[model samples]
Target: MFRLNRLTDYAVVVMARMANDGCKVRTAPQIAEDTGVPLPTVAKVLNALARDGLIVSQRGASGGYRLGAPPERITVAAIIQALEGPIALTACVDGQSGHCESESLCPMRGNWDRVNNAIRGALEGVTLEDMTAGLFVPMGERRSPAALQQASGK
Candidate 1:
């Protein structure tokens, strides 16, 4: 099965949290508390993202993390790559060279690239904004829960 690891899932959730708040600088502990992820894991995920420029880090008394770019400018593929490296599914593809014993005889050896690229393209179509779109109110249409409740005549 093609599956992303737990850290990648956490990375998406963490970044989505940052994106939800307009990429505001947030401490790792604060992120952990808000996202319900463990503090150590949040730190680790933030480090990985910072190393890849997916997130920016600040140092000293006000140190914290934020997205390197706005949510709409960042693609899901970039996030996945920052945490998981390239998106190729098989050893025979992605320029890895000869990890598979049957590379010389396998008919499907060179075909996986098509599948990989298609998947990458699909992921690229989705932005962090797309990921967080339904999580809260829109820019102009923002409304509080109480307001919505009263409007519903509850």
Candidate 2:
């Protein structure tokens, strides 16, 4: 059940679209049209991205939003964290106490830590430029050997 929320997915789509446009200043409507995202949602995502310093917003006529830094400098992890919070599979993995009273005695605590780190590292390996270049893989689209096992029916 691990998955990105709708807003985070939309944010990545918006950013990837912007990067595909050579990282130019794009109006919300333009991005909405290009990415098939709703106008209001695009506005909300843009505002969040700007507030996170991931993008810069311009006002007045002929103004729009553009990347605050080069696309190459922004990682997928940054985008997801901006839209969501820190990437942690479980609260305990992120230094937060779990609802389970026996969290202190959980046998899989270290395993969850390693799992969290592995997932974070995979996301950090992808940049906005990779997204723009169509080299980025969505969570469901990842095709590692372990993932392929499901299809192989092994």
Candidate 3:
């Protein structure tokens, strides 16, 4: 099964928390608390994200981190790339020279590239905004608990 490693999954959770919070700079501890990811893991994910230019870091008394760009401009593919490198399902599709062992006899060598590109394209279509769209209601649209229960036929 194609799956994201734990760190990549944590990174996405951390990023979603940030996107939900908007452009405000958030401390590592705050992010850890908000996302329920461990502080050390949050710090590690933040470092990788900042290094990849996904989030900007500041060093000072009031310093923290914020997204490098708007949520709508950042795609899921970019986040995956930032945390996990390229999204190649196999070595042959990675586009690196001389990395695969079966280059001589592999019939599915170039075919994997097509599959990889399709996956990448699908991920690129989803943005951070898309991921957190239904997480919260606007202030004007919020209803009381009773109203919510009634609306849901509870």
Candidate 4:
């Protein structure tokens, strides 16, 4: 099964919390408390995110971390890439040096790239804003078809 590692999952949770909080800088402890992730894990995830330019960190008594760019500009793919590197499902699709030893003999070589790109594109289409907003509307609040059409500018 294709699955995100625990840390990647935590990173998304952290980011979603941050996005919901707006541009305010948050300490790792604060993020951990809000997200129910462990303090150490949140710190580790924040460090990786900062290093990868997903979040900016400031030092000293009052300093904390904030999203490096607007939430809408940050894609799920970027967050995954920051914590887990490229989103390829297999070594053959990674396009890195010495990724696959059977490249010369494998008949499926290069074919995985198309699938990989498709997955990446899907991830890229989703922004942190969309993620934080979630996939389902509230139970009592359903948009009328006209409202949905208007929202989509159709």
Candidate 2 achieves a global lDDT of 0.85
> Candidate 2 has which clashing residue pairs, if any?
none
Candidate 2 local lDDT, 1-154, one digit each (tens): 8899999999989998887676578999999998899999999999889989999989989799998888889999999999998898877775556656788898876567788999999999989886665333466787777655555456
Winner on TM-score between 1 and 4 is 1
* Number of colliding residue pairs in model 2: 0
Work out how many backbone clashes candidate 3 has.
Answer: 0
lDDT of 1 by residue, 1-154 (tens): 9999999999999999999988578999999999999999999999999988989999889889989999999999998999999888886666566698877888887799899999999999999988885564566997787886665466
All models, RMSD in angstroms: 5.5, 7.6, 4.8, 4.1
Candidate 1, pairs of clashing residues: none
Q: What is the lDDT of residue 93 in candidate 1?
A: 69
If both were scored by lDDT, which would come out higher, candidate 1 or candidate 2?
Answer: 1
Candidate 4 minimal-lDDT segment of 10 residues = 130-139
- Local distance difference test values of all predictions, in order: 0.88, 0.85, 0.87, 0.88
Q: Residue-pair clashes per candidate, as listed?
A: 0, 0, 0, 0
The list of candidate 2 runs beyond 4 A from truth reads 134-154
Where does candidate 3 stray beyond 4 Å? Answer: 136-154
Q: Put down candidate 4 lDDT per residue, 1-154, tens digits, no spaces.
A: 9999999999999998988888898999999998899999999999999998999998888889999999899999999999999899888875554677887888888889899999999999999987776323455888787776666566
